[model samples]
Target: MITERKIDLTGLKCPMPIVQLAKLIKELDAGEEFTATADDPAFCLDVESWCNKTGHELIRLEDSNERLVAVIRKKISEVE
Candidate 1:
């Protein structure tokens, strides 16, 4: 069984995937895991860099199997 929060950006372009991801990230609580699938070829590297720059943890990056799917986990930060 596939147990993960899936965000599909299969028909999106560059920047859109990241935009969508950013929106989702903001709504995600700490310790939540999100898997995003994007058709944008540059998204693989873009999101990776974005994650690194933003301090979000990237669990895995599978870019060339069947689609561009990035596994990301939120950091521990208590929200008010």
Candidate 2:
């Protein structure tokens, strides 16, 4: 079963939003998903890059009003 979560980073700036996201993602089980909302103008690009680098799926990204919303799915862990 996949679990969904949401995080609000609207008032944060720069790396704080990404930092908080990373922290939350750590707590989620593999295949779980989350939606994050932020007001920082750089959030869109930052989220895209973060997902790519972290191997998570960036399912959707869009702007609503003045806020940026991102949907992401956690990647399954690989055994080394």
- lDDT tens per residue, model 1, 1-80: 33568899998987788888889988888778999888788888898898887778999999786588889988777334
Q: How does candidate 1 score on lDDT?
A: 0.84
Please give the range of 10 consecutive residues that has the lowest summed lDDT in model 2: 71-80
Question: What value of lDDT does candidate 2 attain over all alpha carbons?
Answer: 0.92
- lDDT by candidate, in order shown: 0.84, 0.92
List candidate 1 segments past 4 Å from native. 1-3, 78-80
TM-score quality measure for candidate 1: 0.84
Candidate 2, residues 1-80, lDDT tens digits: the string is 66569999999999999999899999999889999999999898999999988899999999888789999999988434
In model 2, the clashing pairs are none
